[model samples]
Target chain A: MNRLLAATLLSLVSSPVLACDAVQLGTIEVEQAWSRASIGTSRPGVVYLTIRNAGTEDDALVSIDTPISGMPMLHETVVTDGIASMPHAMEVPVPADATVALEPGGYHGMLMDLTQVLKEGESFPVTLTFRNAGEVTVPVSVQGVGATDAGCSENNG
Target chain B: MRLTRLQKALWVAAGLAIVAFGVLVTIMNRAPEPAAQASFRPTFSLPDAEGRLRTAAEFEGKHLLVFFGFTNCPDVCPTTLSEVGQVMDDLGDEAEEVQPLFISIDPERDRELGLAEYTNAFHPAILGLAGDQAQTRAAADSFHIYYEREDTADASGEYSMSHSPALYLVGPEGDWLRQFTYGTPASDIVSDLQSRL
Candidate 1:
């Protein structure tokens, strides 16, 4: 009975880990990384995630690399006077003890010139380089074409 | 000077006619103006994916759902187009009455990048439109859509085109119907279109 119970518990513990969850590195915790399924491979893809800094010192996301795209850069979408413009962001600042969210219509990681099509229900790895925390690779769940959030539960299937 | 019965009856009829006329005028004045009267009716004459020239007049009997964006857009454009695809799906059989047009603000690059393939990835009902610089500017001006190319280019010698993100709805008679702001849910748009249809 003890052996059977252990097996069941092990499966339960491993299940959630398989899903796109959180990854911790040093004082930074990255979670809820996700991207929408790309419509075309020629068009650029985007990644949105949240970074939480627990340390006293501030950190900034210096660079991002993903195998899906050759060129990954930080971009901010700004809307002014009804015109939407996306300017390249050199880095995203993560203040100490604060959470910075890279979401839709705001800050996002632009995956330029995607090497492959991002299909729904698939997850990919993106390595984010932070000035203080170094490099932390997190799995990004691919949601529906129009999904606004990571929705890890829904994408787990 | 009292009038005879026939004269008195005619005077009463005239008085009632004047009151009815006054009420009619008041109702007319209070009625809401047509949407086209309140706003400009946008028009576009551009080339489709097949390089066929298409004009606003061709879709006079159907509702036009227009969005201006470029193929190279990373986030907002794709998200909005996906929502539009969902809206078209939710519309079901009623979808035939609707025509969705994705006008490329960056016509040169969009044409080279295959505008049709990009839009078809979202929904087949969406017709990708592109034109020369002058033609594109004219169409954008008619819709009051502002778009400008950034002066800087990335390492790949590629630049970004900034443009308006609002989705416009035009009636069958080419009247300005409504504008759906960015991030509006597909369900909400479906309900709105159903009511209007």
Candidate 2:
């Protein structure tokens, strides 16, 4: 390229307006992730994790990413009339500079199709990809054996 | 440090023997307990299938047989509900004294209409209880219930929850009574409930 063209390109690439901008990337903070102990039989499991807004801009959790399973979804567990129902949570709101928690029976990352049983004393990595917070991976701790009250003490029969 | 060839061979043989012994032991181990221990009854506050909040006090005057399940539950929930319904029917009027409550552990999708429709399939008066996380947990806690949300990928390209399958029996005062095995017969259950009653 000619000297004039090179100078112009350099000026554009190294523009002063593009330098020292903190608004380029949003910051995110993830809290501890844990789940009840895995049961021996084919029991259910839930993974709990917290996502904090560490930036000034508004953001939302568009989706969750997991490497251990084919698909990771967001779901809410509700009880109406006298039945327990679970429905998909298409999008979890993580307002600007706010935190959204994924806990039991709430907004949690529903890992579909476990490649392997979630055995006790063992943890596998799962990633949550947020709309603004990006993606963060965590090793969830499974709780409660075939136990229904997820975190409560066992009934010693 | 390197081990001698003989030492390596011995170690390998020992490892193989241990592996074989482990396999033998695993095979000898009997089947795991199908249901959780039901040493005591539990209390909870959840909405009935009609969408009305229900507390353990709703049946404080009589025995309560509570099971955590959902309307949409294909095999486990329906089976347990039907069996319990049978046990209730076998009890005749005594079954009236022993209130049978079906509390949905999968509350998110089990709304009032859904619960009513699903529960009515098994038997009338199989009261369904559905609550939010906090209310559901409290009720489950009283019963010492255990359940978790297992994610499943659906064909339509979404995920579903797989939860714990268990049943509980609370006393007249809403105290933890006992839990039944998944395949427990109605006869045995009626007998157990009669003894308690």
> How high is the lDDT of residue A38 in model 1?
82
lDDT of 2: 0.60
For the record, the alpha-carbon RMSD of candidate 1 to the native fold, in angstroms, is 8.1
Q: Candidate 1's chain A scores what TM-score?
A: 0.84
User: CAPRI band of model 1?
Assistant: medium
lDDT of each model, Cα atoms only?
0.86, 0.60
Docking class of 2: incorrect
lDDT per residue (tens digit) for residues B1-197 in model 2 = 89999999999999999999999887666345333343554667777765677777668888877777655443345446767767777898787788778777668767733766566656676787788888877776666556666554455533233444546677787666566656577788888988877
Summarize candidate 1's per-residue lDDT along B1-197 as a digit string, tens digits: 98999999999999999999999997897687643245678888999989999999999989999999998888889878888999999999999999999999999889988988888878999999999999999999888778998855645677888888989999999988888888788898899999988
Worst 10 residues of 2 chain A by lDDT: A16-25
TM-score (C-alpha) between model 1 and the true structure: 0.80
Error of 1 at B31 (Å): 21
TM-scores, chain A, per candidate = 0.84, 0.64
TM-score, prediction 2: 0.44
